[model samples]
Target: MATSSRSASTPGWPVSGAQSRPPAAQGAGGWTWALTAPLLVFLAIAFLGPVLLMLARAVSDAELPSAWPQTAQLLRDWDGNGPPDDRLAAALGTEILAARRAGTLNRVANRLNYDLVGSRSLVYATGDALERGASVRGFADLARIDRRWINPAVWTAMRHAAGPRTSFYLLASVDRRLDGDGRIVQVEREQAVFVDILLRTFLISAVVALLCALLGYPVAYLLATLPSRWANPLLILVLLPFWTSALVRTTAWVVLLQTHGVLNEALIGMGLIETPLALIYNRLGVYIAMTHVLLPFLVLPLYGVMKGISAAEMRAATSLGAGPLTVFLRIYLPQTLPGLLAGMIIVFTLALGYYITPALVGGGADQMVSGSIAFYTNQSLNWGMAAALSLLLLVPLTLMLFAGRYLTKSVPV
Candidate 1:
């Protein structure tokens, strides 16, 4: 008998068939982290780095504090109710001359303008006098460039702007600002724009999410109940648009809904109307395009939940004297609640930040929070306001993302 010796730790299996043991535990554990290290570094550099920079910029102090240190020291001690004193003007003039020689006056001017609308011109005029070798001895000589420098509002704005940090951008997001004394206060009624835009963003997103739910639920049910051979093709159709370019799809809607485009032309030729409908470049267009684009997001979640439900559950419920409605409401709907919530949250959050579709298909009046963020960043060059608005949009999405996971875990499979 050819018998093989076995170690005491070995299981009672054929010796030749035993699996080979690893030579090192360290390679399996440490090498796994080594493989993922590059991805972690890449994510830190590409995503987290920019987000941190944006947040830092959002709370950054006004440039006046650094650009004119002497003026800042003076402003720190002076009573804001007092006049634009000669010492304050002399310090600003000296700073402006120094800044012009250093070629960084424009940045200071831009910062000043953020505090007072016409302060940019004031800074520039002072800078130009200094650059042209005009001798400015004191506040009286500096006021020659602009009489507004002696004005109380200009001094008040300058005094308030001497900051190491500020909450101005964050406050402005909700239609608030600092008063002359640096106290937080509500903005004028006409200037109260973003709160309305924020509300409109929520309203539009809610409507689009509801539309997706209403239209997608039945289609998802049909897909789940159908045979796989039929359901596969239907599922492909649902996913087809999602695979296509979002820009292209939004553009297609513009063409179809435009006054003289395919849909309007076809309707006119069919004698359906005398004039083309006002569909494109309005809230109607925004809603229709957003709902279509988000419909698949809702469908996929519901379909996954529906497919998991056993047919035996329904039969058992019916045998227990449950009607069709009763079986669905009592027996099936409970199982699908997690999916329903997941779909709604996904659709709503996505719609909240939708920029391209709304910009392409919607009028200015129909634009959302994302549009305002873009306008502030690109057109107005207000990075702080843009970053704060982005925070507003991001916070809600983060909350919903966690809430979806918690709710999904709570539901019975």
Candidate 2:
């Protein structure tokens, strides 16, 4: 009665205790976000911002526009029905001279080279002619400077690359290209490498995951089943890899697996073989080094999940006339599925992006997509192709990540 001034029935008054609690809850949530704002901002800037910029480069065609704006605009306006007109030709020559003088001609040349072989030479030669005051009054004069100028293929390459945005890099990543007729087609057999590399990436990841699973399960089981007095030291050993640098670990493998290294020496001393095994710098070496590097990743999660499993269920199943194998297969294994899948996914995802391990231990045939990304980034200086390859690598890894999460959640406990 004393509190009747604000009753439940009163409009704009709280209906229940739950409703009255909302302001404090909202205040708490606001404080939560306030506390986390710095971390969120850090992730956005440090992680998301660079990733987005890289992905944008996959579709970006800014080089031509940046270095040869007049020519890019003229090319955009020209219909691809025939060769560019004298006006476009003159504009190209003039801009080529300007770009060459400005030291940005390589930008335009490299972009066109992505589509047409020897286009860099074409662009450089033409720019050199124009810089020396060779007249380019018409398409014919421009064509005289380089016969490629008369070829529709070169014009088509220029037309495709004269964009603010393009799918050229993305298509090329998957071993496809846009032809002069603008039709999507497979790249030449010699150039059709990325798809195979992608497949090899998946194959290597799957095999490594499988190997980790096969090898890790027993180790994790031992860690889980052993008494704490005995398990602590083993657990420490399992976690030991985390304390070491991956570079050091991979180097250790290189030391061990090299032809004249410890393992081969030991094997030869035992009269196990007449020659040193081809253990390093091959797919076998890749598998060995990667599995060793990644084994701990698979074991730790599995050990945690395995420890949570109750012995009572196994006892009950055994008392119900179930054999040891049956109890394990029908009871123990299913419970471990979530962690098993989770750990394998983590291993596989990490393997897909592996660079240093393969680079140090694997041969040319064993190189993964990350190698191509590095080659483009460092060697070829093709940022668009690098970003495109990174994008392609991300797509499947993202899908596998989601699938792993779903399977981990959906698997029956």
Best by TM-score: 2
Relative to the true structure, candidate 2 reaches a TM of: 0.93
- The C-alpha TM-scores of every prediction are 0.86, 0.93
Q: Local error of candidate 1 at 266, Å?
A: 3.7
- Per-model CA lDDT versus the true structure: 0.85, 0.92
* Model 1 stretches with alpha carbons more than 4 Å out: 1-37, 73-81, 84-86, 135-137, 268-274, 411-413
Off by over 4 Å in 2: 1-26
lDDT of 2 at 146: 88
Worst 10 residues of 1 by lDDT: 14-23
Candidate 2: tens digits of C-alpha lDDT, residues 207-274: 99999999999999999999999999999998899899999999999999899999999999999988
